[model samples]
Target: MKLRKINKQVWLTEVELDGYNVRGAVICGDKKVVVLDTLSHPRDMETLSTLIQGRALIIVYTHADWDHIWGTGGLIWEDARIIAHTACLERFNTDVPVTLHEKQLVEPARWNGVQLVPPNETFQDEFCLDLGSLTLRFYHLPGHTQDSIVVFLEQYGILFMGDTVETPFPCLEKQSPLFRWITRLQRWESDPGVKTVIPAHGDMGGRKIIQRNIAYLQDLSAGKDPGVFEPMTQFYRETHGANLGFALNASKSDAFKLDASKKNNP
Candidate 1:
């Protein structure tokens, strides 16, 4: 893991997972130190202690995807609060452990010290944490995954996009609400307060990143390709193919038009 202090109160950490890069952020507020996603392993988070000092700790999971939530053991103790969307918490009872077990079975040493830590506090659509000078507001964006969300630093004009938005294109899953996802991205793109968009797997940019994702999802929803993409890594190239398959199936679902009006699964 490589950590770079973004400012006096914010830090960015990046880790290589397989061939793709995953990112995590730390925001230090007057009252607490909040960590967003823990990256791929425990050692990836080992340096958090020095950055956190003795401040109260809070861990927020952008979603329960294994790569994003697996490193809690390195920085969390009994008192730390783990926060996420309610749907993310539910994943712990189902796919979360199953994924961990499967990876451990494949290579025990690599995933050995990782623990499955579920969020102790969860919300439905939106949640906010007041960090003195900054407020970390989380909203359910629900594109990459039902529990996926984006974080907004209201005071800093920065948005932390988990996997809801990516570099070349956004990946699609079987039950993704393409309509709702595009709608939400459109909303964010229009927000003047969202000056910087930082995604977990891509270069950080301004509103253009959000705009690009919106365009990709829009094309997918219309049953059209989202135009040619710049050359991406082998992982993303493979992901684009899978995204097309999922989008084809999603477009056939009755739920496509039923999106953006209500919470995806609720």
Candidate 2:
């Protein structure tokens, strides 16, 4: 685990999970310290707890994916408030526990200490948190998952875009609202305020990253192969294949729902 500084207020921590880099972030504020995502396990949070001692702690789960929300134990001291989207909290009763059980069966020791912690606060559309020096504006962005969201810190011009946009491409699933996701990304792209873009997975950069992801999703919707001449690591190559399957599944689901709606209305 390594902690790198993004700015004076923000620090990023990352860990290697199956040849891929998964990241989390910490923002130190005058009134509170906000943890973006908890990474994979309790131990991943170990390296960051000391830097944010004493102040009121607030943990935000970008979503309930296993890689993003399993480390709450490391920073749960003073009645810390865990926050997420309403759909994110709903996932706790569903996929969250099932994912933990499946992983524990494979690596009992590695995941032995992990405990699932659901968010204490949730929002339907938008929410905001004030950190004294800066404020975090949260909006539900449902491209990656229904529970997925993006946080904008206006003071620093940083947008914490969970898994909604990733490098190379964003992953799609049957539940992924493909078109809705692209539209939301477009809104951020046109905004002059979004200077720094922080994603939970892959390389971090400016607004160009958002533009590239938008282009990939558009090509994907057209059924064009997103093949690049440059060499890709084995992990991304495999992920790209999986993404294709998921996109196809989502498209079918959308069509089926549309047909059902038309039949009922007619």
Q: Which ten residues in a row have the lowest lDDT in candidate 1?
A: 257-266
TM-score of each candidate? 0.96, 0.93
Model 1 misplaced regions, further than 4 Å: 260-266
Candidate 2 achieves a global lDDT of 0.84
lDDT, model 2, position 263: 34
Please write out the lDDT profile of model 1 over residues 1-266, one tens digit for every residue. Answer: 99988888889999987888999899998879999999989899998898888999999999999989999988855799999999999999999999999999999999988988899999998888988788888999988999999999977888999999999788788889887788788889999999889999978999999888888888787788766677778998888888888988877777765773553443
Which pairs clash in the backbone of model 2? none
Q: What is the C-alpha RMSD of each candidate to the true structure, in Å?
A: 2.0, 3.4
Alpha-carbon shift of residue 131 in model 1 (angstroms): 1.3
**Per-model tally of clashing residue pairs:** 0, 0
lDDT of 1 at 58: 94
- Which residue segments of model 2 deviate by more than 4 Å? 255-266
